[model samples]
Target: MASRWVLVAVSAAQLAAGAAGQVIALSEGRAFDIDVLGFRGSPARLGRDSWLLGTGLSAPVLMLSVQAVATIRLAAGSSRGATRVLGSLGALMTCGYLIEKEARGALSPAGWNPTTTPAVAAGLTLAVTMAVLGPRQASSSS
Candidate 1:
């Protein structure tokens, strides 16, 4: 029961954070562009129509939504296997983000920042916890 609630809370947090990021990106494109793309130039000079940026932002939001739904299902007494699968998907999304940040040199100068590292950690933790818990199987009564 406690584990289920923990999963719910973590999933909700991820969903909220992902939504907030999208809102920020839409409302303040320049700032989002600089923080994410590591643009050294002025924010005002940054263009907003990059498909790469759209893809980058879309993936996490989608995964977070999926995780939230899975958490809800788990809370409703769904099988742990389903929840674990969704959790793994979320972790995979986080892994991709981590790799992207590394490849883009985002973590090179400042080490792990507050932006995506926490999300990656949370996702991985959730996945591991779910995996450890294992699937809830039906009882076979005689």
Candidate 2:
């Protein structure tokens, strides 16, 4: 929130999260609803089990709107609220990535994912920490 770099980092994380959701949904296949992806189709035909699927930073319009508006607010340097929202969104995105990977493999086999990258991991952590705990307080010279 203090530096432009943090804003860029958070924004980048948001974009990554959006992409990650799409990839996860595609990989999920069955419960992946076209409706959730902005098209029209009932997930019932695919035997939808978990609402968690087709959700996250790619959940229809909610995430998109939230991310868009929040990013704008942040870029304007207008609100800490924006950072909080950004942080929360980042956490959700990171969680989706992690959950999908873990369900596929319990720290075991099955190749890699965007979430596996160290930069992605660090970015998400920083964003989440910013949201939940706010930017680190500067040490007082007093």
Candidate 3:
């Protein structure tokens, strides 16, 4: 029970970290390509906001929303194979994103990125939590 709450909190913190990064990037006028579906769909450029929404229409919003729902499902202990798969994918995606950001010079390559370090830590925690949960149990219905 307590473990579930910890997972949820960590997941939320990771999500929050992501949101904060977007806000900062937008405020700093950092022009970057946001993946529409994370290597699936076309990348959309985010910069030069006209209405000031910035990233409100970006895919991260959708991604974070899905993650939020997944965290709730995991907390309910109803998550199984798909949950693990998505969790791993999300963590890997975060890694890839950080690397990309570094390459793009949005993040300092000399050392850790102050803006994204929390995301990395929270993401690592979530990944470990999912690993500790292991694979899905064999269904009793079988």
Candidate 4:
């Protein structure tokens, strides 16, 4: 349905943005610039290329999840609880990335990196809006 496609497109965009952020972090030589919670050491120094991969990996997951929600919404005429959870999680991730980027100063946290705060904010806003908007059953013909 058109709605599902829209969700998929939105998710894809988010994923792409995240991937770009990660690339930026790596290129800037500050990959993992933000400490993971209490842990220290940068991912770049740790030789964690997988971390970068992880950023890329998140895109599919979000896309798939959005597609699933789209299907469920189309079938049931409402967004599932899972979508809400994902939205909240996304918001948290966005905030964490923002915080890390802010802490890094000049370097930004990838995979939700806030160096591009506006993008992050937009993503967060979209996620929240989608969650709140729930889903409308796709018209049989439309």
Candidate 5:
């Protein structure tokens, strides 16, 4: 597949995940999983449908890894400087994912927390990289 298209798809996907994360974070009537778990002790006991939706936000977090590597590889064909930027973005994205996952695990334990800003920033960086890198094309022979 064309590398430029890959970046586009990944960027769009990142944006989607970001939106989902915000939705999960803002959903009302949600409970702290530990409290809910201790009380109800079952998935049904989890309460708040949004808790289930919160887990879905990670889909884009994981996608950022694929986007970053693909962007890095595509950048390798152009400028080393651009490659570094792509690589850095990719690393940040991965770190964001790990950080969010860890934070969610640490804080919520029973489900996703959707409260990490770093993850959101990392996702934004990935989206920006797609724009920064622009479309890939064969070098002009001139």
Candidate 6:
């Protein structure tokens, strides 16, 4: 029970982080682009496709929402397999993001922000750990 709640809390935090990033990207795209991606040009010059590609607002938010609901369902005694699958997906997404960032040199021209890489890595680790643990131990043994 306690473990399930912890998973829920972690999932909720992940959701919040992803959603907040999306919102920030949408509302103040120029700042987000500049701060996170190290873009120098104006937001207007970024264009629609560039903004969508750079911000990644859609897929990440959708994935995080799914993970949050799955974690909530797990806490509510839903199927362990379902929760595991969702958690795995969440973990994979985060890993992919981290890998891409690393491939790009993970550099922020504005200097490194602890909030960016560390937070995502923490979320990824948590999600992967939860997936590995599966549902509650008591339920799994039954």
How well does candidate 2 match the true structure in TM-score terms?
0.50
Tell me the spans in candidate 4 whose CA falls farther than 4 Å from its real position.
Answer: 1-3, 33-39, 46-85, 102-142
**Comparing 3 and 6 on lDDT, the stronger one:** 6
| Candidate 2 per-residue lDDT over residues 1-142, each given as its tens digit | 2554465455656565555544554455424333323533334533243333443224333564676687777677646576667666656655544544332232234434454343334434544554543232111111
Error at 63, model 3, angstroms = 1.4
- TM-score of each model, paired residue for residue: 0.51, 0.50, 0.53, 0.46, 0.35, 0.56
Q: Order of candidates by TM-score, top first?
A: 6, 3, 1, 2, 4, 5
- Report every candidate's CA lDDT: 0.46, 0.47, 0.47, 0.43, 0.43, 0.50
Task: Give me the displacement of residue 31 in model 5, in angstroms.
Answer: 13
lDDT of 1 by residue, 1-142 (tens): 5655665565566556455444543444422223354633233532343222322222344455666677677668745654565556555645544544332333345545466445334544544444343332211100
Q: lDDT tens string, model 3, 14-121?
A: 666556656655564443433443432222455443123223212245566666677777667745543554455455545445444321343345645665544444
Worst 10 residues of 4 by lDDT: 52-61
Q: Report the C-alpha lDDT of model 4 over 1-142, residue by residue, as the tens digit.
A: 4554554445445555555445544555543334446433454553364242222112223443553454455345434453444445455445544445432343333534445454445444554444433333122223
- lDDT (Cα, tens digit) per residue for candidate 5, span 40-129: 123343234323322322323334445445555653454444444443444554444444433245335464344544444445555455
RMSD in order of candidates: 7.0, 7.6, 6.5, 7.2, 12.1, 6.2
- Candidate 6 lDDT by residue in tens digits, 14-124: 666555544544564422223354633345643453333434222244465566667667667746655565557655655544544331232344434454544444455
| Candidate 2 segments whose C-alpha is farther than 4 A from its true place | 1-4, 27-61, 101-108, 113-142
lDDT assessment of candidate 5:
0.43
Screening candidate 6 with a backbone cut-off below 3 angstroms (N, C-alpha, C), the clashing residue pairs are none
Q: Which stretches of candidate 3 lie over 4 Å from their true place?
A: 33-44, 47-59, 102-142
